[model samples]
Target: MLPTVILPGYLESADVYLPLQQALTALGTPTTTVPLRKRDWLPTLGGRSMIPILRQLDRTVSAALVDNQAAQINLIGHSAGGWISRIYLGDIPYTIHGDVTEAEQLWNAKAKVANLITLGTPHISGERWTKKNLDFVNDNYPGAKHPEVRYVCVAGKSIYGEKKLGQWLAYSSYQQTCGEGNTWGDGITAIKAAHLTGAINIEIEGVKHSPRTPGIWYGSPAVLPQWTGYLS
Candidate 1:
């Protein structure tokens, strides 16, 4: 079995994915997480650039490859980390920061990744603050661009975005993600925005975006079985 690496979402730390790592390992897949701390995300607060996070992701992938003695591994990215993984998979130069040095590039990670699983990731976004990075990802590496890697996009259908107070947060998040608010989502990303055209798209009924959210989340033990089958 290929080893698995988990990349936490924006502002999330490796600790937050401990449950998920343990769950995957328990399922007979050796799993590890990119050692990211909340403070590490501070450098990219304004969505300036994800180069820093990409650096860490590359290091972790390299280490996982060595530790497992495997040629490739499965990559599971959550939220912003998903799109960032798309960038890592592509050979297109990441020029969001004005001509990335060759040394700073991820050296095309797709070659070492057998599967790319995304959890409630907003593949499309309308928010101005996130335009730069999202634009770079969508424009360069569109839905399931790589043929060698299996892309599995998982969406949650726990919340229906509405104008009402109870669902306003999901409404706003959906609007920012896909330019529509009155749709179903995982309290953070709309189902439409989380799926990729050429990927194996899946939707789980009651799963939220993050572990901190009430009820089960993408990384929850119950939800793990829903998407883990794709890794095989």
Candidate 2:
């Protein structure tokens, strides 16, 4: 099987995904985490342009392809990494905010991508930093409609954040991500937003947004059975 490249979420470093990478390796899918960090993403985040980060992801993809010596590789992206992977898979145009320059194509889609698995990714975002970029992703790629690649979306159902302490943290995150907090979600992302219309959608009962001390996220060993099958 081709090795899987794991992409971390926003403001997260590559090391944060080590637990999940270990789990996937044990499950027979060799994995690698993209060496990404918050400092590397600061430019794109502040400038509202995803060009730099997308380039970084592409470099990782190229390295994975060389390391595994395969024509195609599996992509596992968490949170914003998921949508960013979509942009990486095609020749999509992107522009910097407040810049009058013409939009540029970040990736040329020459790399072969076999499967794409997303964990608690908020495909839709209401925040200004991601809204326009996500709009481009949703409009062009739109769900798992890509003809060549298999798309799998994994969602968490542990915290809805409707009231109390959960409301303050998880609910606020949900509201920021999807514009509502009275629904079932993984505290950071909503199930409905995490899934694409034509993709393989899965909902885990107690998964959180990421691996925590007492609970597991999508890549934790406890929940490997839920979405590992798609790695093939």
Best by TM-score: 1
Candidate 1 similarity to native, TM-score: 0.97
- Global lDDT of each candidate: 0.91, 0.79
- Local distance difference test, candidate 1: 0.91
Candidate 1 local lDDT, 1-232, one digit each (tens): 7999999999999998898899899898899999999999998887687888988999999999999999999999999889989989999878667646876667488999999999999999999978998998888888999999999999999999999978999999999999999999999999999999999999999999998887899988877778999775
Compose the digit string of candidate 2's lDDT tens values, residues 72-120.
Answer: 8899889888888888776555553544234544555535788999999
For model 2, the superposed segments whose C-alpha errors exceed 4 Å read 95-105
lDDT of residue 5 for candidate 1: 95
Clashing pairs in 1: none
